[model samples]
Target chain A: MPYGYIASMKARPGHRDEVIDILTGGADGLRTAGCHLYVVAAATTDDVTIWVSEVWESKQHHDDSLKLPEARAAIAQAMPLLTGEFFTQETEVRGGLTGQP
Target chain B: MPYGYIASMKARPGHRDEVIDILTGGADGLRTAGCHLYVVAAATTDDVTIWVSEVWESKQHHDDSLKLPEARAAIAQAMPLLTGEFFTQETEVRGGLTGQP
Candidate 1:
């Protein structure tokens, strides 16, 4: 089964957009690293929270992606801008519509 | 901007599959109702929680879908199997990969 998670993180008060940019900027590397889906979104009712929903070819793929140079760099850059508050729900992707966004 | 949310609902014990069936069964109509993506997932570490991640052309499209006959039927059928526990996070989709799942 495909591995996935929907997670949220809070950015330092004025850094949400910068954090979002850093997160979304690594999409190309993620795709080549075996990602099936990677969506970055903003919490509609808040200014500092961001949500990311991702699906990977496998759990191992997801783990490995985090170790990739681009991925690590992105995370490092965003960490300082974040507040360390996070929420995550790991999931097994059963089925769904893809490619329409 | 595209509208989306990642929401989770808990099923009654031993009824997760039934609830999943009911939820995924409505995909066809949801697509016709202007859904861009509709993913039904199972929580990796739990048996009763089901996660649904969706993106619609507009919030109105999502609202209209819940009023569709099929949608209502599905909801009615699944409610009895649910625990009433739910979590929802509304989002404004920024950018990411789609259609690869």
Candidate 2:
């Protein structure tokens, strides 16, 4: 099944832009690595909260992506900008731009 | 530009599946109406929280979609299952399977 995931991150005060850049900057690479959708969105009502919505070819594709060198590097850079609070959702993508439709 | 949005909803206790169904059941019609991606994801750690990640042809497409009869009906069906607390993110979807890639 396709892997659908949403990860909510809180950036430290004044670090929202930096975190968004980090997330978007890595998008091309993630796409090349099998992510069908990699959206980086900032919450409209909360300046410090950013949401990442992703659709991967499979659960393994997503899990394996975190171990990629580029991903590891990006995470290291983004970690400092975050406040360490995150809300994650992992769902079996039933359809839509996930190529499941 | 493509319209990307994420709306987080809290389903009343034991109503998560119902919300997910209401969200997913509307997918086919929405897709036919210009929604490129409409993913229904339930939070892994929070059983009552559901996240909808959407990509529409444009912001107008998304806004207009809410006025569709099918969408209107779905909202009416879902409102009672929700807690009225929602977090929304509206972003300029730069690229991805949103077809902007």
Candidate 3:
């Protein structure tokens, strides 16, 4: 089974720019960690909420990235700007039709 | 058929408390609007990314909450504390095992 993580975030209103800067950087960090199926989709509306979808080659690879400087830097930089509870989870993706027409 | 949304947000480091305040409020607002399968799971680590999992009775109902004071309030209050791009997506859940163990 493939391992993936889903996490949500909300940006401070006027500071949306700063938020995006770090988020883009965070994505860069994950890329170096070999994150696959990584999709960072910003919300369409003006709300601060965001969606982070990532599929890793394996759970071990995902866990290994925690030691990387890029990952740690993003976390350190992100500490002061969050306004609410940050959510994250690791799950096994199961089931879905893939029939091709 | 049902509708669900997944969004991600990251909190500024030291303000985790303030962030949780607004997030809990946001969840309250969502519940009033009749969200189903709403799971607001906080990340286990010090990193800020959050995961918001919500299932609506229907898409229309989910959209209806946009007008609620609580929803808007959460957004306004949450603006300055974020440090990264917020991601959101409407998706259809497909597949999984349901057999009794």
- Model 2 bad stretches (over 4 Å): A97-101, B10-18, B31-34, B45-48, B57-59, B80-87, B92-101
TM-score ranking from best to worst? 1, 2, 3
On residues B1-101, what C-alpha lDDT tens digit does candidate 2 reach at each position?
A: 66779888899999988888888887877876678778777666777888788877888889899999988998999999999999887865544343334
Ranking by lDDT: 1, 2, 3
Largest TM-score belongs to which candidate? 1
Clashing pairs in 1: A98-B99, A99-B98, A99-B99
Q: Per-residue lDDT tens digits of candidate 1, residues B1-101?
A: 89988899999999998888888876866677899888889998889999998988989999998998898898999999998999898899988877663
Query: How large is the interface RMSD of each prediction?
Result: 1.2, 3.6, 11.9
Q: Residue B96, candidate 2: how far off, in angstroms?
A: 4.7
By DockQ, the candidates rank as: 1, 2, 3
Worst 10 residues of 2 chain B by lDDT: B92-101
Candidate 2 lands at a TM-score of 0.76
Q: Considering summed lDDT, which 10 consecutive residues are worst modelled in model 1 chain A?
A: A92-101
DockQ scores of the candidates: 0.78, 0.39, 0.04
Candidate 1, residue B57: the lDDT equals: 90
lDDT of 3: 0.58
